[model samples]
Target: MNTSKSAGEIRLIRLDRIEVLNPRERGSRVFEEIVRNIKTIGLKKPISVTPRIDASGAEKYLLICGEGRLKAYQALGEEEIPALVVDVPDEDAFIMSLAENIARRQHHPLELLSGIRQLLDRGYTIRSIAEKTGLNHCYVQQICNLLRMGEERLLIAVESGGIPINVAVTIAGAGDDDKAVQAALQEAYESGALRGRQLTLARRVIDKRQRLGRAAGRTSTTKHSHISTTTVIRTYQDEVKRQTALVRKAEFSQQKLLLVVGALRQLLCDENFVNLLRAEALTTMPKYLAERVWPNGSHA
Candidate 1:
């Protein structure tokens, strides 16, 4: 996070003056627990606040995080609370708040990734995103890479804990190369990271990518627009059967053509056959077969 524009100072601010720009709904039970904690142990962290001028040209503070704590303070009838004041844009403040929510594990896995993606979109450095989200730098970077390539399937798998991020990255980098993807999955399987149903899931995901593409459809996800296992299996089987039939037909045609070529080549070696063909004006053979029977276009 660009420190020059963030984490300015900690100061007391009126609770009524702070506007929760991106407030999340906390369960009643959770809210009560937070109130109890603050009452018993006092607030451990201060709320994050950024100043913005309203249409009336009056300065007001926007709450970036610490909603629970701020609420706890209000419940305790406290008029003012300590807030970490920062000077940043509304968008940056919102992203910071989202990162803080993710840090607390208050968001879905996809939401977490989306928040990281938003930060990356804002041109936040990987280290900066890691700092804001309280995530590992490598993890943030991996998420950025996955989002950049639009590896929606692998991203879903990663979020669902179906595969490792490294494995997903490997498979994604493999692109349309099935062999490379298979190799990457095989390595994951060998490492004991991917097994059993997850192994099957990995295969299916790769199969989906092969048949369709890496991107998930507009509204597709595991819960919605989900492709069934039987569907994927049937599709694979049908493709294999079609390909096998084509190869078999090609082989049969090649055998018949070779037999004809062999007989014609033998006839071309006979003086009578050559003379008879020359006399009948049906002497011209295809250049390919002629070259095959008579080396360097030489006549018998």
Candidate 2:
């Protein structure tokens, strides 16, 4: 646990002699960056190591952390770099590796959740896992909720920050019945039809229904009943009409704003240059002229 820097002489050792604790768990980007940096400026930071005693009382050194840095050094063809040798227990080695990897590059929430779940499945309690991973218990619980979601797309949304963890946890708790609700929320989000507070509100509504279902010991059903082909066609027609009305309203508003801007511009021009007949409205022209001529005139 001691992190105090101690200067030691650089010694050349066979690269294969060092034992890497968690080689597979190392972040790829971090490893790549370390390689690049070592290729450019050499290994700036020496790796931390610990000495192990063999059966014959022979002492050997093992890398406690810095697998990425070690790989980068090896890639760069460096024979020796200063290392900090410390005595640490074997049980803490994997935890240290996990923390180092996480610190180097943040894992996606879902990825982190998966790692936590793996540890849990291996018989580690939430508290023990949290202590080992240096994550909060609440965070561990939130990640466990991913199992409840049962939908890969929904889990991705949560990991990408498109959905809040609490909202995701609610959706996960919905069991099988919430599939339609989750789908609806996903469609609204991807289609840009729902956003900001409205998206959150929709998630809350779905979550509330899910909670109710759990309490009742019954799965919640989609409110939208299956429609016959004729009914589907009729519904499509009704939606088309609604959308057409909306588009017209938007177009009208845009036209009005454009007209107002044009009027404002015409009024700002020299009075002699303005064509009264060509203007949209004589009333607007006079109002513009009055505003220009009388500085104190009430625009109201």
Candidate 3:
């Protein structure tokens, strides 16, 4: 981004004269808070804009950043607000705006990646975007290629933070090469980014894309989140834990049953106790007990 020749000088501009080049959708709660903050403390940093002359020879200011502050001023019934004027081309101005928006706060991984995709869709070169956004040139290239290939499974994994960007890149770079995919999974597993279940997930996703093609893969992949690469591994881990607990409980019950049956069989084998029970008129046994103790149907 080019530094302003104005050198921090703030100029007051009318609200009507400023036009936002790209209007972003902000939640009402956030917008209201912006309005409240400006009302209470006033504008801390001046909004940035560029002077543009329309084809009709009318001049208007193209807003490069600070739409929130601009809108807050309007809601506050203010006619003019301070702005920092910049002289740059439209694309540079837009990139500058995007950089500021991204740098303002931590963004959700999906939102940040989608924003980069939006810039790519706008025909900006990967190197230019990397330079402007302070991202690794290679990383930006990989992201552009992955998004271009419509590899939503890998992207969703990255977006969900289940897998890191580098891991996703590794998987996407494989692209129909089974050996490469296996190598990528091995790398992820060794690096601790992927566990056994996650490795399984990565393989399934790659296999689907390879078998059904990207269109079908994306369709089936999204309809059910249980199969999604992001949540599937965790879900499988939870299920494994539950199954192990059930098996342990079953084994415990089996042991207790064996102990009870052993004690009963031993007591029944004693002639003195058997004769005593008979004398007490207790010859009949429950059918289930008889079936277990004497398998030949001999109750006494």
Candidate 4:
């Protein structure tokens, strides 16, 4: 594999002739956001492509990256789009796509795992993947090890920070043997791979999985669910309503507290109450609560 960078040509290419090598599922909100920004400011950067010649000697291009931008242009019915045509091979193009995907902070763990698996399938060593993707070698190995163990749930737990990456790797490769998993967990604790809440979460995951008759090898047909634009908007609206209600409740409580404190301060000024307090030697007043009732140092 060529590790050198290619300085490709920048030209306008017909959208119909470019094929998407790896298509990713983008939420409608993301697509719309891209479209809105592009419409207002035009495209900020050109999409990347690699030139290819078909069997019939016709020239076409493979899309290396920028699926969202390309799709936005297509939605606008643009026939030709500007692209940077590179002279790299198909393998490097795929790597570039994978690197871009992994670089995104919003990318799902499953999507990242898929990209890593594709690279591995293409005979790229784990070390090479680490170097190409700029991921830590240990992290790359951990993900590959988890995939090999078929530990989907554990992988999700790891991604969610429920457990340490190394601990997940250890338990994943322990097969379905409970004793082996426990032993591995103990080893992780001893080696500082598991500590604090991470150790607790790891034990809980093991117990929950075992109780549900689940293991790393369990074949779950469930795929990652993508929320639509409508769902996202609805969720945001619901959250706003909930927060508004909480704010209103807090304001009401504050008003009630002020009323109660004000009444108490008035009662404190009464001769009988003042005499009782003087007799009991409680005249100092609870400094904290008194300050709230008399913020300006005027009791009444």
Give me the candidate number with maximum TM-score.
4
Candidate 4 structure quality by residue, lDDT tens digits, 40-123 = 899999999888887877788889889999999999889999898787878888889888887777887667877888888889
Q: What lDDT score belongs to each candidate, Candidate 1 first?
A: 0.81, 0.60, 0.77, 0.81
Q: Comparing 1 and 4 by lDDT, which wins? A: 1
Q: What are the runs in model 1 whose C-alpha is more than 4 Å off?
A: 1-16, 21-32, 39-42, 71-82, 87-99, 102-107, 127-135, 159-161, 174-183, 196-300
- Model 1 TM-score, all chains together: 0.53
Lowest lDDT 10-residue stretch of candidate 3: 215-224
Could you tell which candidate, 1 or 2, scores higher by TM-score? 1
Pairs clashing in candidate 2?
none
TM-score of each: 0.53, 0.50, 0.57, 0.62
lDDT leaderboard ranking: 1, 4, 3, 2
lDDT for each residue of candidate 1 in 88-137, tens digit (9 for 90 to 100): 87788888788787787555566676677777777889998888778898
Better of 2 and 3 by TM-score: 3
Between prediction 2 and prediction 3, which has the larger lDDT?
3
Please write out the lDDT profile of model 3 over residues 1-300, one tens digit for every residue.
223345446789899989997677777889999999999999998999987777777667889889999999999999999999887888878878787665556444555566787798888899888888887788788777788877766776665556677888878887768788888888889889887766777777676665445433335443345446645676688799999999999999988877877887899989999999999999877776677777776644
